[model samples]
Target: MSNSNRTPEEQALMTKAAAVLPGGSLGNLRLDEEHAFVVREGRGSRVIDVSGNEYIDYLLGSGPMVLGHAHPKVIAAATEAMMKGTTFFTQNAYAIELAERIVEAMPCAEQVRFVSSGSEATYNALKVARAFRKREKILKFEGGYHGSHDYSLMSLAPSGNTPFPQPEPSSAGIPRAIQDTVLVAPFNDLNAVEDLLDRYHDELAAVIVEPVQRTIAPQPGFLPGLRELTNRYGVLLVYDEVVTGFRLAYGGAQEYYNAVPDIAAIGKIVGGGFPLAAIVGRREIMESYDQGSVTPDVYVPQSGTLNGNPVAAAAGLATLEVLREPGTYEAYHARAATLRNTLQRLFDEAEIPAQVSGIDMMFDVFFTEHPIVDYRSTLVDKTLNRIFDNTLLDNGILKSPGKLYVGACHSDEDIERTIEVFRLGVAAVRDA
Candidate 1:
């Protein structure tokens, strides 16, 4: 955990990385030099840094390592698949099998189309909706991340001066024309969504949302209300289930919440740590993808060279097979509940003004007294949150600054040790 122990080999790589890579880091995450680490290897619930320092991994490859790193079943499946061929650039049996699995498991997936990433899934989902409805605009919640695409980048981290439905571009490169197509509203606020849908329904193609936006779960009627509104307005309802897909339940959030959308995008655990994701929906909406199924005006063409690559499909199929086994979800939720409740109690006992948000599978504590329901509410104590996260890293727990993913592979011992580390993290926050 200390740089003093870093081997010359490790230090040399860091120097080389800095010379070749922008910001001396992968764009995914940046830690200060004192705490920066390059992952050497991962197995089960732990990751060993390049310097051989081990930490309890809570990032879980940013949420795809649900079965844990290099799971034997996943590895075996991928290896077996690789032996056959890596990529055919055409339809493969593994792709068909994985598509069948997704259609069977996901409530809204009557038909499934594969893509190479979650961003592609969302982007394509939007395209399909627009093609189907003959409308150009879509609504997304503020702070709800659909991925790094131009449309998704709007209002993702707005400073909050902008009013509802007005967009703020999170990144500079996004075209100015994109701002008009995306409308932003508060998460969990059904009224705002309804109002926007009412005004924009004629121009609105779909309403895309993360069922659980970041760490905030939807209030009881939120998702169902969205479904009702979208149906009434004749606009497609799209769930960006990239974070909640197979991780939430066997059927994902659509089944978990009993709120079926017209279409959905799924990724993360569905790929089993590989670069595979999908745009799935009703047969009618999904029909847009087939060049022969629709008129030229409405047809939406989508294809990725690596879409549904066999190795990823094999790993995904294996992961889903294991997930379907009885008691996997129950056991996963039980451990998650323990971690959630334990952290909340620790925060309370320490007299920290904290609100733990998110579902059991993934959540984080916001260092604030206010309830966390939207992006603006979460900014109440950025300084405190920043210190708390760094404390977690200092104590050897790797996690996203925004969320900590709990995996089925995390052992009882791992959870116990993590609790001890969580206490250390909370204490450091208290002292700071």
Candidate 2:
């Protein structure tokens, strides 16, 4: 299905949007005019465009809508909390409860500090690590996205062979000094990380990584190796689990992989589709956030007005309760696995040279025969990826350009329709 014809009202909105917003869109997505749409609303694994065209939503609000759009339980919780009041600058009961839940659920969390976004969580996690260790430099993996902060932007999507441990700034405004503070290494390459730790441990505060580096699963021994080396170096290990937390498992990647880091940043599902994120770690490490607990020199001053919005926390608590239901994860995994395998099979049967990469819960096609083990390897067939994703949109399937995020609310009908879309998508790619 090419995009349904836009109504006059929608066309006017797009024209208005073009005049007002940068790039005529959100920074996250830019679609061709023929395929562009403004979402009217979303419900249970589906989104309707302003033109009244419904799409099977694989984007899932970029991976936060795990229970799908407007889940009843979350709505009720948030609505009730909204009735009470939106937010208070002072401590609130719901935030405390949510903090308790995070500390209980996250393997690395003995204490937690709330924040308003995943970017803030990662930035604060790094700041706390620096405060604790009295060190300035941090090591992050190539292509590991930790958010848009200056330190996190280093080598996020560098295409150049800049050699190991050299930071590459993908964005322009980042100060040149940031390149000196952040070191880059390849994901899943233990030897490179060991070398960097050996040489720079004295100045390094921590090593931050995405355990599942943007849909590229960690190789056996990788996470353990990172934990061991960071521990040995007396440097912190921070897992940027904003995408993987609760999405991967109830306790996040540290629990799923059985390799715990010193601190972790969590977001997405934990917020129940709201703008809440958290930084969690061991009690001693977390003391940096408590001015009274830490010496003046090492104290981290962090405060946000909406850090613990009652409505957001109530919705998150309700979401976590729903996720705790028996067999919920199994069902979610099973549906995702079915889609993953079917898509892989579709590509194979169509004789298209592609690899279905990532875990069942979040995966996508890499249009190449080569195994996708790192960011550099993923560069192969980049053009094909663009074609395939655009084809999916043409067929009424909405997914992120990089990953297809699955949610628990997908019905049998949704599954069947998505699978049929997969076949058509692959075939279009095969012919293209």
Q: Clashing residue pairs, candidate 1? A: none
Compose the digit string of candidate 2's lDDT tens values, residues 1-432.
354578888888899999999988987677777788899999989999988888899999888899999999999999999999999988889999999999888999999898989999999999999999999999999999999899888998897588989998999999988898999999999999999999999999999999998879889999999999998888899999999999888998998999999999999899999999999999999999899998998999999989989999999999999998999999999999999999999988988898999998999888888888888888875777877877778778899778999889887788888898787788778777
Q: What is the lDDT of residue 221 in candidate 1?
A: 90
Stretches of candidate 1 exceeding 4 Å from the true structure: none
Candidate 2 local distance difference test against the native: 0.90
Provide the TM-score for each candidate, comma-separated. Answer: 0.98, 0.98
Instruction: Give the per-residue lDDT of model 1 (tens digit) for 1-432.
Output: 557768888899999999999988877677767777788999888899888888889999999999999899999999999999998989999999999999999989999999989999999999999999999999999988999899999999889888988999999999888897989999999899889988989999999999999889888999999999888988899999999999889999999999999999999899999999999999988998899989988899898899999999999999999999999999999999899999999999999989989989999888888888888888775687767777777777888878999999888888898898888888888898
| Residue 154 of model 1, lDDT score | 95
| CA lDDT scores, all candidates in order | 0.90, 0.90
